[model samples]
Target chain A: MHADPKGVLTGVHFLDGDHACCEGTLAAGARFSAGYPITPSTEVVERFAWRIPTVGGIFIQMEDELAASIAIQGAVWGGAKAFTVTSGPGFSLMMEHIGYAAMTETPCVFVNVQRGGPSTGLPTLPAQADMMQARWGSHGDYAIIALCPNSPQECFDLTIQGFNLSEEFRVPVMMMLDECVGHMTEKVVIPEADQIEVTPRRYTKLPPEEFHLFEPREDLVPDMVKAGDGYRFHVTGLTHDERGYPSMNVETQDVQVRRLQDKLKPLANGRALCETENLDDAEVVVVSYGITSRVAQRAIQLARAQGIRAGKFRLISAWPFPEQRISDLAGRVKAFVVPEINLGQMVHEVARAAAGRAAVIPVSHAGGSVHNPDAILKAIVEAAR
Target chain B: MNQVTLEIPYEIPVDAHNPVEPFLRMDRMPHIWCPGCGIGTTVNCFTRALLDSKANLDKVAVVSGIGCTGRVAGYANLDSFHTTHGRALPFATGLKLANPELQVVVYSGDGDLFAIGGNHFIHAARRNMDLKVICVNNLTYAMTGGQTAPTTPDHVISATSPYGVFEPSFNLVALAEAAGASYVARWTTYHVKQLSRSMEEVLSKKGFCFIEVLSPCPTLYQRRNKMGDGLDAMKFYKQVSKIRHGAPTSECALTKSGEIVVGKFVDRDRPDYLELLRGQMTESLGDRYAEPEVSCSC
Candidate 1:
């Protein structure tokens, strides 16, 4: 479906990542947002609050992160595309509702502008520590899509993709941006509304009598219906049957929980968003994402200048981890040099995907700042040897 | 109050049709509510209120949190949501704001609404959000096996208060009024007629409307306190209840075995959240501001 022109700002402009994300939210046709202010991520909603009033939407500053997170789901069921934004502390507070969204298959977006963490760490500094949490923080055996944007332009681009993937899979999509990207100013080009493709919500065509709220279609996603639509659908956070009624049996749990993970297998395979370069002839690969990925690009160039064949693998979709692509590269590459702001998070995923076929070297930083390019270059040169 | 053009019938017809059945998910019958629990009785009153108010059933959405009373949303055959514990108000706030046409109702337990969800309740009421909140106050957390709740009366015995509760309980009606609810009322299961009337009144109102229904948790709250059963609790309500139509809520706190004050304490005018938002936006933006369209084009 074409983007709603009423929401799309069709022009090129200089903007920060936070402000560009707000434009992406509008372009994606989200008409309702509820949020609480948190550092590094506050500007996203700040811009949203200023812009939505003119774009014909509502932005309610809720009581807290817990309320902000679930309120968006309520708006989603009311038939509006909705989202919430937060940083580390607020993101931790929103974990339960993220689980609730996954359980009930509510489509929404959660934008986390990452900051140094473990409770009120450097609130103004960048970190990729939340990459692991975005995949597993909501205490459950469920899968979610997390996208990492490296720049202000990609922040604008991936946020729309985040909403589309959320609607397509009926799961909450996390737009993971670090403090550097969120605060850094850059130029962003926004195309016309017709050029921007949006995925419309899949509402069921079946009559009220025939429709089951949680009955999965062939694609394993149930069509949705909004409130006041006379469908009289019931949706709950508990383990439920296809009819959307709570059934606390082992059998029901097996069917419901397995589908939440298995349905996203396609995302793990072909639809994975990754940028690869020089891998066909390279001996060493530098795997990275978010702001750290930009720094790793410099490291890859430095390694090649020293007569070592090093390649760049920039992860755009961080979760569902692009396992197959990494495993494919693992057989051919001699080593993988993983650089991230965190001590060692996604490095483990890279190691697991490599599966003893190649060496895995971690270039870790304890966060508050992005990694130095020389630090990653040192690891790449050692792995190449 | 948003006036209902339909006239209030002088005598409500006692039809052969079961009023509650059509409003219930009969397939999900044999509900999880314990026998002798008064939560079911409140649901009965709610369904009758829907019938009396001539509400568009399709437009009414029920949202509940986690508790014995929270199960009402699951049984309700409206477009319902069984949400996380203590967060129903915020959820309902989203539903009501996203689609102003929806008559969003938040039905849950005292522990869910008054304890963990206390902040959301106060903020939502302070905003005068257009939501009808019905709290089934069973005095304790019956779903979690009769733990001491924020509404447990002083000197009452509970699982967490084995020695006896020293803490005070909330006067929900007073809290509702103090938090800026446009309408606030208190009733008990024994006052079935009045409870249904209050529900009907709140349904017709536009701002934040609160009705606290003091109910019996026969297997837990009552039994733990040595109050015989649900019938005995109902008789006790009949004996000690005082019908104070406009009494000050400050003087209406409940005791373990004292006079139970039941009444509609506040009925006042205030602009709801959406009204203030739209009014302010339209004034500033003028022709540039367009009220949000219903998200579903269908």
Candidate 2:
């Protein structure tokens, strides 16, 4: 732990969403950053490049997102906590490597401050549309851990958590931000360096001869060793056994895929893995994540003041969808209202978890604009009535 | 440094019993490539280049994307990464940047590099990242049962291009040069020695280096185009290739009869992206070595 020259959590300052994300990444013990300049997300990289080096870290403005992503992965392998920030178009380019990290179980972080897009729909605007894509964009059956930060502070705190989760699970963790949260400036306090808990990657204490790169421990997360650490372990994206050698055998494939899925699925069901707000005894619940969650929260508060029973379920971890929480809440709530920037994406998940217990209504808007609180409040009232 | 010298008077074989023997896994012999495949020869050239460059063996990381050429990483006795399809460059990029000391090489097929990963290829070249990319342009997707790839020439037939490919082929050397690759070259298996030399040059280049090897795919491409077996493809290459030491940039285009224009295309330094970034960072801080301002709010 480094000493805090600045008192812990004493600095209160206002910044845009991008600067907040940049600061959050630095505070989270990110010693290396590599990124390209893409609109809305560019500031995150610019700020990171300026801030990372001052903390005795390396910040690189890479040739593109591909290079940026690759550099961050390399830094992580070199035993440094690393990350890259990009928007929708760049995010699309990073999908393949993101899957590679997941398959290889390399610990790293990626922040996608999303813009509206199937392809460059809106560069300067916000969109929660990437929610579904973040979970299923890359080709394959693998689980990913993605967190949505509602405010700049959450962005700062969750960026650290993203690094921690990545190191703990030995997998790539995504900090899913939007143009809104990425660019939205708010007063945020930087924690003292000593106060912030930074988790370094776990290394094998065993002799180099006994080390296996992909050999899962009893906890299912393997202890990773870096390339030049004298431990020669083969790693591939192919389905492989504990030795990390390529194996196409059905049984081996099943086990490998199951391990990737299992590592993150347990957290989705457990209490500590997700966040829910004001759901007790509520008749109407709005299910949302990312920037839209903030809008839903405001609507929930407004609905409550207007004599309607409403609550909000803000998902911090979005990938292993809070299925159990939604399922449990379905029995008590009259209806689940899903407000997302994209049309009916998360609503499908809510509907699946609802399983006919409550009506799952989707209030969606496509590209640039966020789902307004009025639209959500109306849904809460309609669900309540 | 301690200097030790030994002298051996024995005459070594001209072809060296197998120049690839030093780096290859002979136990994994009789590779998975088809009888007429030129991939074996391409792999042979690559291994020879590695031996010639004397790159730090332990720090060498070979990252391969999906395709027949992608399997080269597995065959090499080094730190290998068989990554996802069309992602070898990005994976290699990560590997190189993470451990700047490591020599990173990306090997992928035409379908992997030019089609799905085309965007990454151009961007990587433009950034001039300190990594080497070797694209095996067999002109078709041989791995997926001979599908049409981006490099498949117009009027060439494949599984998906039964009526002849309508799309014009991408000239890889031109593409690399346009995208700002610090080093770009092209060669075929027929020019084995020249191809090997080009590989060495790319390996030695400080920034993004791209080499496209026009290999033959006898099972899919050769059989469909009636180009005969692997040996026949080599013979065709020998007769058609027009090798010039300093060929003009305009003359690097593909000619009829599949002639490969072999030579270095681009070799100039433009302070690599990472180096420029570091210089700027150092200049900005200027003696204030303490922790930089870190605030979540902008």
Candidate 3:
């Protein structure tokens, strides 16, 4: 489907990642947002608050992150594409609702502009520490889509993809941005409305009597209906049957929870977004995402300048981990040098996917700042040996 | 001793159907409420109000937080959401703002709405969002086995307060009024007709309207205390309750044994969140401000 022209800003402009993400939400046809202000991530909603009013939408500043997170789900069920933004502490507060969104299969977006944390570590600096939290912080065995954008342009581009994937899989999508990417200014060219593709919500056409709210189709995703549409559907956060009624038995739990993960199996390969280069001939691959991918690019170039054969595997969608592709490369590659702004978060996934088939080296950082390219270069050089 | 049959006072006719059955998920019944519980009674009043007010059942959505009363959303035959514990108000806020055409209602319990959800309640009321809030105040957390609640009166014995509660209790009607609700009222489940009428009244009200229904949690609350059963509590309400239509809310705080003040306290006009949003946006941005569309084309 084509993007709504009313929300698209068809022009070239120099913008930061936060502003670009806000524009992406507009072009993706999001008409409602609920947010609580937090450092580094606050600009995204600040821009949204100013931009959404003229674009014909509501940007509610909720009481706190708990309200902000669940409020967007309410908007989604009320028949609007919606999202919320937060940083580390706020993201921690939103974890329960993220689980709620997963349990109910409410399609929405949660943009986490990563800042340093265990608590309030660094408000103004960047970190990639939230990669694992985005996957497992919701306290359940549920699957979610998380996208890592490396630049302002990709921030605009991937955010739209985030919303689309969320609707397609009926799961919450996370647009993972670090403080560097969120704050750095860059040139972004926003295409015309028709050039952008958006996925409309899959509303059920079955009559009210026959429609069951949680009945999955062939793809294991149920078609959704809005509140006022007379379907009289019931949605809850409990383990429910296909009729959307609470059924608290082990059999129902097995059926319900399994489908939540099984539905996204298609994303592991066919829809996994990554930028790969030189992997066929290269023996050592530097795995990275977000801002680290840009830094790793220079290291890959420096390794190519020498005699060592080092490749680049930049992840665009970080979650679902692209394990199949990594496993395929693990057989041929000598070693995987994983560089990230955190203390070896995604690197563990790389090691697990490699499964002793090849050596895996983690170039970890404590993450008050981005990784130094030479540190990644040193890992690549050692792995090549 | 041989068992002697106690005479049954009333019987449901074999050919008759309940009037409120159409407004409920009959397949999900019989409900989970304990015997002599007042949550079901409040649901009956709500369904009656829906019928009497001629509300478009299709356009009404019920949102509830986690508690025994929170299960109201599950049995309600409308677009309903059984959301997370203590977050129903914000969820209902989003529902109402996203589709202004829908009538959003938040129905939950005392501990869910007043303790953990206290911030959301006060903020939602302060904004005057167009939501009908019905808090079934059972004075205890009945779902979790009779814990002391924010509304548990002083000196009341609860599972958590076996020594009798030493903390002060909240006056819910006073809280609602102070938080700037468009309409605020209090009633007990014993006042079924008046409760139904108040529910009907709020359906047409423009902004945030709160009705605190003092309900009997017979299994946990009444059993923990020396209060007999739901019937005895109903009789107690009938004996002590006095209706003062515009009484000062500050003086309506309930004691362990005191006159139960019940009436409408706050009813006045103020622009709701959407109205204020649109007005400010239109004033600042002029024609550039497009009023949000009520329904998505998709």
Q: Which sequence of candidate numbers ranks them by TM-score, best first?
A: 3, 1, 2
TM-scores of all predicted structures: 0.97, 0.84, 0.98
Error of 3 at B78 (Å): 0.7
Q: Can you write out model 3's per-residue Cα lDDT over A1-385, one digit (the tens) per residue? A: 9998888998998999999999999889998999999999999899989988778889999999999999999999999999999998999999999999999999999999999988999998999999999999988799999999999999899999999999998999999999999998999999999899999999998999999999999999999899999999999999999999999999999999999999999998877899999987899999999999999999999999987899999999888789999999999999999999888899999999999999999999988888888999999999999
| lDDT (10s digit) by residue, model 2, range A1-385 | 4423332233787877778777776766666787888988889878776555656666666666776776677666655667888888999988877887888898888899888888988999988777777788888888888988888888877887888788888888888889998888888877667767766677888876687778888878888877655554567788877867777899998898889988886677773355566778788988888888888889999999998888778888887788988899888889999888887787998899899999998898886888779999998888888
lDDT of 1 by residue, A328-358 (tens): 9999999999999988999999999999999
Error of 1 at B221 (Å): 1.1
- State how far residue B139 of model 3 sits from its true place (Å): 0.5
Positional deviation of residue B32's Cα in model 1 after best superposition, in angstroms: 1.4
Candidate 2 chain A, which ten residues in sequence have the lowest lDDT sum? A1-10
